[model samples]
Target: MLDRSSARDEVVRLTRDLVRIRSINPPGDELPAAELLAQRLKGFGFETEVVEVAKNRANVVAVLRGRGDGPALMFNGHLDVVPPGDLSTWSRDPFAGDVADGKIYGRGSSDMKGGVASMSVAGGLLAASGEKMKGDLIITAVSGEESDSIGTRHYVERNTLDGIGGIVIPESTSLELVIAEKGTIWLEVNTYGKTAHSTQLEIGINAIEHMVATLHEIKSKWESIGYAKDPYLSPPTINIATIVGGVKTNSIPDRCTATIDLRPVPSQEHPKIIRAMQEAVDGMKGKLKGFRGEIKVINERLPFATDPSSDFVKMAQALGPSTLGLPLDPPFGVNFFTDAAIFATKRSIPTIILGPGEYDLRRNIYLGHQPNEYVKIENLEKATRFYYELSRSFLK
Candidate 1:
């Protein structure tokens, strides 16, 4: 029989084990982490699956079926994390999963392994309790969240969500629930010009100059056009991520390109946004003699939102605060996107983001995706209890 303290220790141990695996995202290889999670799930009587989405990247899906028919609740989290840059800057090994001073330090600790472990342990507890749940409890440790969200997209395409009532994405939110988030689109802008020696400035149109001028115009009006406002989210914004042109300093190159990252609110249609961006570039064609521009969309994802009054939202809102003995913050929006959006938008599943990662002011501990990334064991335990209590009602 597992007592509360023992269960907490188990969750902490699982988190440390997961952190020890190096599942960094540029070349995301989550199979090792997926295998570890699968082993734990299987030991708890879950029917587990290790799904390979790419060469060495895999997602682990574990299911604990109920005896009777009821709404299915899915707990989701990613196994892959952003690369821990410059290891020399870290006080402890980023992959060591070092437990020091009451916290686990590692690259993925707060960004999500803590949340994943909590969800996994919560599912295990439910299975071990032997209570007859009315519905299925699904736990998914997905890959590629830090990059393209390939894992969740593949999972949604293959799995049916007809019977699933809600999804809980245990992304680190410091325990405050996130119900909505912004969408994103990546664009590449290209400009054309004639190549000529630097001495003959008038003989060739400068592609970089033309591109810079066009971007200046776009930046001036970008926020005002097609901007969507929300009580919980900031207005949509655009950032110029990269630019490349010319072969050498002395040449007036024939080609130049710029990459853009645009975040749109829920009301902005992707097609319309693309059109507006294209028009911004095309409008420059006649303005500059012997110069032309083109806009190409590299990637895109939709913003996600769910009815605040839905049974799923109410269920999470009621459970988290009650379990943690803290006042719950109102459901808010986040600027960044997550795999939760994939499930909410693609599968039409009501999804909520709730987990640990809130910065503890007193402890001087910083959050995820940085040097010395760590998660408090107390927060991990609380998150596990929160998921357990929420699942009990939602899966009932």
Candidate 2:
């Protein structure tokens, strides 16, 4: 049987090892990382496999079967992290997985690999100890969470949550239990206009100018309407992510496009949200001279919430952190969206997001998708203990 101390050390080492792998997601290649995790899980006596959902993208699934009759439990974490841009801005190598100042520094350290390692170590400990739990304990190291959540979505489509009791998504939650997340809508808006030489300014229809008007209309009329305020989550927000226009300084652009990100609370519906944004873009049709524009949904994911009074949530709260031995604060809400929505909404599995690291306004830490990202070593150990205890409570 592995002792607590050994488990903690193993968690740290495993996290560091995972952080060393460059599993960045724009292209979303997680095969190498998934293979590494699969090997370790197999060594720990867990039934492990790497399933490829897309070319070069894989998810690692490991299960430690229990001896008694009880519902299965699943632990989920993503394998891919956002790309580490501008290496010069970082204090250390983004892929070095260096440990210093009581933290493990790397690209995926805080955003997730730390939590993934903790869950793996926890499952490994259970296997090593040969504990007679009541149900199966499953760990899924998924890909594409940083982008499309295709990995978890693919897994959900293939697997059933019929016997599974609950799911825990170890995203960066600062140890607080997250019961709800916002919905997401990505939009691409395009404006068409006639191109002409700069000298013939009156003859040319400027697409960029039309796009600016569209943006103003969207910000003023579209965002303010639709969607009610959620008591716990934030109000629906809109962000213009990217814009492209004009081919050359001398030519009036014929076409312009902009990408926008819309985050709405649980009360909002995707269809209504899209319609609202589309209305704003279409409003520019006759208002702006020589302007015709259209908006299309690029991507979307629904908001998710689980009843906090569920047996699983209560049990998780009671288990708390193994390190502190103190009661944690009441469950809270997270504004960010996650793949947990897939399991909770699609599979109808009760799910909660619990993990280490805090990157909110209170912390002023930009660990996720930022340079010099890191997760505290102590937090890793604590998270390992928490996952182990939670798994035991649910599965055993």
Candidate 3:
């Protein structure tokens, strides 16, 4: 059997090792992390595979079989993390895996190398024990979650969910069990116009000017008529994430593009949201003389939410972390998206995001995808214990 102290230490080591790998996506080099994870999973006595999704990037799915026909369980974490933009901004080397002041500090630390480590070590401990649980356990360390879920999409499309019964997404959440996590749909809107010389600005339609007007209109509708306020979560939020297009200031620009991020709950109708945004864009076109651009839906993502009173939620809450070994504050929804939507979409399973890390605020506690990201040593220990009891509870 795996000793608790030994197992915990192993997990800590796993975090540092993973952090050292520099699996930064969007110049995506997740192979190092994926390769290491595949080796680790194999050493832990699970049947593992490393399959590529895009170029050299790969995802690992390791399975441990249980004795009976009890419901199966899945532990999932993404292997890829966002690029650490400026290294000089960090106190230490971002990928150095520096352990300091009761926490491991570096890129991918809390935002989720820690979660990945915890789940990886959980798999190892199960293997070391050599005792069969009540159901099959899948340890999936996927790639590209930070970049667009290319890895997960490949896995989901290629594999069947025949044996899996439920999923546990061990994302960083400051140790609380999250009942609902919002979903995001990435969209790009383009506005077009005619170019003109500086002196004759009116001769050419200013796409930038038209874009500004359309943007204000879109934001107004987004704020007023399109608002969806869940008491637990924020009013369905809209983030104007990016905008570009234009040359020298003297030139009357002919094109402008805007990228918006929308966070919605599962119950909210996503199609209507898309339609509203489209109509809002269409309405602004008539105001411009030479406009030729049209807004189009670029990509879509599903949203999932779970009732706090449900059995699965209660089961998770039973082993959830708290201040004094009692039920903590009521669970809430996160503005971020997780694979919880995949579970909801594929199996109609009631999946809730749980484990360590924070939401709504950027803390070292959750500096995921940023340089100097970190997870507390204490938090990792707590989650390990919690997940152990949670697994045990599943049988009873």
Candidate 4:
């Protein structure tokens, strides 16, 4: 049996240690955090390797061997945290890992370090227990999840998934079993026009005006198309995130650019959406004079879902209540995407998103990338137990 008190203390300590190490995403310095986890896993008799994805960006892959050859169960979490914008807005140091009111406060504490720590500690405890199982338990602490899923993407590209059966992403899901998530398609649109004096309105085309018309048309076209609704997820939506055009107000702008974020459900196809957007732009060409524009794909990730009836999800549901001391609710979906977009969909592996982060928006708690981020100590303990129980049951 695992020592509950000891595991709780170790998880709290590990969470604090991880928070103190700044692995902010813009510069993505996750090497130190990766090394910390690597060393700890190594101490637990795991075959550990630290793979550097970029300069000062690293991923830690560790495996606790099973007695016989069987499928491996993988647990993945990202080490990178979004930058803490404007430190003055915080009541405590974002990196201090301060403990008060039965909560651990820090930038990444709730977003993921808390989940990471709990899973890591659970793995360590399981290793120490020397309980023989049928398959290996693989743990991956990856980088570059905040900006792009580069670390997990690189891991998928370079590694083989032959022996891995299913994956569990300990993201901030408030311990909910998330079986489906929306995918993302980021697009950059650029419009070009001749530059001239502001007074010469007839000679030079206004690129900003052209961009406005293009956006209106695209929105209208998308809204007009009928889409099938997903039972678990909301309807696919598009947002105009950012726009930049003119350098000077006195001159007609020569160019304008806008970045768009389109989130699609599993029922929607990305290529078709892209085609429709292009068609909208093409239609503007004939209707509006000198409306020259092009669309470029910045990034894309396909949405993924695992059948709730699958054995893996069923097992998770079975273990949920006993492990977390709460009733297991129906499997749900999330709007945000995760590395699972690559890890699960690439090979069609069964995946689940469950973690300790406070996701209930009504509670007015800080979540990922928010100021005054925190994770309740009670949730951390519950998550550790849940991971431990789930891994044990699944690997057996």
Best by the lDDT measure: 4
- The candidate maximizing TM-score is 4
lDDT of 3 by residue, 350-394 (tens): 665665544333232345665567788877777766665665556
Model 4, position 217, has a per-residue lDDT of 88
Clashing residue pairs in candidate 4 (N, C-alpha, C atoms within 3 angstroms): none
- Residue 148's lDDT in candidate 3: 74
Taking the tens digit of each residue's C-alpha lDDT, what string does model 4 give over 1-396?
A: 336668888899989999999999888899999999999889878899999999999999999999766788999999999999999999999999999999999999987999999988889878888888789999999999998878999899998877888898988878878888998989898899989999999999999999999998888877766667876688888899999998898999989999989888997788888898889888988988888999888989899989888999999898887888765558778888889898754688899999998787224343879898999999999999999988898888
Candidate-wise lDDT, in order? 0.85, 0.83, 0.74, 0.88
Off by over 4 Å in 2: 199-202, 224-226, 321-326, 358-364
Pairs that clash in candidate 1? 174-358
Cα displacement (angstroms), candidate 4, residue 13, comes to: 0.6
All-Cα superposition RMSD per candidate: 2.3, 2.2, 2.6, 1.7
Q: lDDT for model 4, on a 0 to 1 scale? A: 0.88
lDDT of 2 by residue, 56-151 (tens): 999998888886488899999999989999989998999998989898899999989988998888888778777789888988999999888999
Off by over 4 Å in 4: 361-366
Instruction: Tell me each candidate's TM-score.
Output: 0.95, 0.92, 0.91, 0.96
Estimate the TM-score for candidate 4.
Answer: 0.96
